[model samples]
Target: MLIVCHPVLYSAVVILRMVDRKLSEIAYSIRESFHDSGYTEIFPPAFLKSDKVDGFRFIYRNKIFVLEPDITLRLMNRHITENSKIYYISQQSDEYLNESLKAGSEIMGGDEDETNIEILRMAIKILDNLGIKNYNIDISLTGIFDSYVRKKDGQHLIRAVKSRNYPQIQDMEIDDKDKLLQIMDTRTRKSGIDKLDSIIERIDDPRIIIDLGTVRQPEYYNGLIFEIYGKQEFLGGGGNYIMKNLRGCGFSLDLQALSKLYHGSHERVEK
Candidate 1:
């Protein structure tokens, strides 16, 4: 009778039950959001061909998950029509592998909000729904779009990471606008930026301030760039990059660190 009572079986059953419950809750929330927003739930393949992404370590095996050859290829290969708005929901494995030889999976999804600003705004909305406020947000806008719209307004191509807790975000106290100007002019004339500059400078807009500064990830950034800070420390950053002639910007939220700033009570994990 004692042999029949296996500890591993009990523990595994409990874990599976907990996981199933969590998945149910997550699915319910997602379904509710999609139903309210007129979005249909979508499913993407768990395994894909790995591609060269900055800071990503992709593994190739008998099974290869790689980046699609081209954006056109992705669109062409998709089963759905192009005009359809997609709401992909799936467990995605990150290129980052753990010691257990398993890739970290996250409940990842994105809505095509169109512009970078709109995307950031949507992200903020999601955070707000979680009762998260008083956090810094990072946004990245492409220079092409920024140069066009920024002529009317100075804001463009900015990456903002939002966090409720103020990290070491300190203003460098850069009083000299001329210094910023010089950096801009010099960098604009450089190889890749020079081309982007020509397209941007063609438009005559006095409101636009073309400032120059280096971001943390150089390989990822091409044209315009910006970041947000809290308490003078960089909580998050991102930049615009032109790939396949499509300009896009993105940012990441440091949730682990941000949790420290939450005013709400914390619940301990059950062992």
Candidate 2:
């Protein structure tokens, strides 16, 4: 059977090819950055037999597979091979055929402070490689949540912080209200990191702001939390987290978003 193609369909095919070429270049550039930074790239198993993950389970060949949401949880498991530094690029299908392409790096099997610095530095280098300078890494922590989470209306407060909903935080009757707002204040991040560290001057610096208020709901984030932003849009981000008993740090880049931004198709970001 011969299929007819409209001029509009031909145009759409051309646009897709252009977009695919751009994406390939971006992926290669980012991967090279990871390699230059001493990170070994790995294609982690897409399906795992154990551990809780965000994906649904399905049986294949009489065996069940749990689709992986991310790699942080696998690092500390005794069964998983531990490495010095690593990164990966992969995607998971959503409810649609198109998948979100992701690329990120991690500092595993390393000192706590050293891991933190290396990951943050790498985050900056990634932004630089992408020509994204108008950005800030909003930093926060789990301890703040661990202590204040038990307070009245705790869940609401967390939502406010994660969404940056100031009115919700202001209206809450919790005792930590004022303190939470103060933490959300970006102006205090430098001083806050300093307060969290005695030798801030000695460390490699990145543009940072501290929002010690609410946090992203991830079981892995039992330590430092951060989100990278270019103005209001999130470029990419991650944090110091515990994968079981071992402490590690890593970040994931939103490859699709960067492509959209670079292509001046930012309006389609939601689509």
Candidate 3:
């Protein structure tokens, strides 16, 4: 029997295969880098039972289960030993049922400065290994914003700062408003800037940008935070956080986004 298929459907199938192949290559490169850096791979369960619906929830055998939204959170629940380096590639889904592929590494229990430097270096090395050169890292210290949050009308002021709403920030009644404004402008060499400067001096990478306005996941990230960006889109980001009373820092890459960038650049080079 001869099977007949539409040309469009065939073309779509071919494209899908190409995409999957490229994604696999990207994941392999990331995993190789992790292994070379002495990090062990970890596999966490896909479905978790929790009262809080942080991810897509479903009923399995009359028991409520939620799709794992955060691999880091799941790792934290485990008894991670001190100075353990672990990496993972996992499928994550959010409350809206949006799924994404993440490749991440976590360094558990090490000197804060050393751990931060090591993570940043590893992130940069992985990007370089992938031949991704045109990228910038936006670094920030959450403590800067946390200090302001303790002040009166702090939340509103912090919101203004994050959004760069200068007028709204000015209208807020916070002490040292000018200083806060300066920090927002990335002009102040105060408090948290020193930490950024120290890291910059050690890393000596011009791609690192001091961005004090970045205060993402305040409840989760306690210290330094950084995001990786390609030419037009965010690749991924991570930061220092306390989990189960343990200090840890790590970063994750959006493997799908990364594959697109890597494939596009390589295709252009070949052409």
lDDT of each: 0.36, 0.67, 0.83
Which ranges in model 2 have alpha carbons more than 4 Å from their true place?
A: 1-5, 57-65, 74-83, 93-98, 192-206, 263-271
Best by lDDT: 3
Models 1 onward score TM values of 0.41, 0.80, 0.85
Give lDDT tens digits, candidate 3, residues 188-250: 223355778898889988888887777665468878898888888789888999888889999
Question: Which tens-of-lDDT digit does each residue in 1-271 have in candidate 2?
Answer: 9989899999999999888977887788788888888778777666566535555566778876666545554444334344458888887543233467788877765776667767887878876776666777766666776556677777776777788888877777877566767766644525545533422344435467556653666666766667777766777778877665556778887887777555422422444
Top candidate on TM-score is 3
The better-scoring model by TM-score among 1 and 2 is 2
User: For each candidate, how many residue pairs have backbone atoms clashing (under 3 Å)?
Assistant: 32, 0, 0
The segments of candidate 1 whose C-alpha lies over 4 angstroms from its true place after superposition are 1-23, 50-84, 99-114, 142-271
For model 3, the stretches where C-alpha displacement exceeds 4 angstroms are 59-64, 147-181, 187-192, 264-271
Ten contiguous residues with the weakest lDDT in model 3 = 185-194
**Superposition error at 154 for model 2 (Å):** 2.4
Residues 111-225, candidate 1: write the lDDT tens digits: 2333333333433443344344545432222333333223322231222111211121223222343443343333332234553343234432221223343333434455444
lDDT of 1 at 223: 40
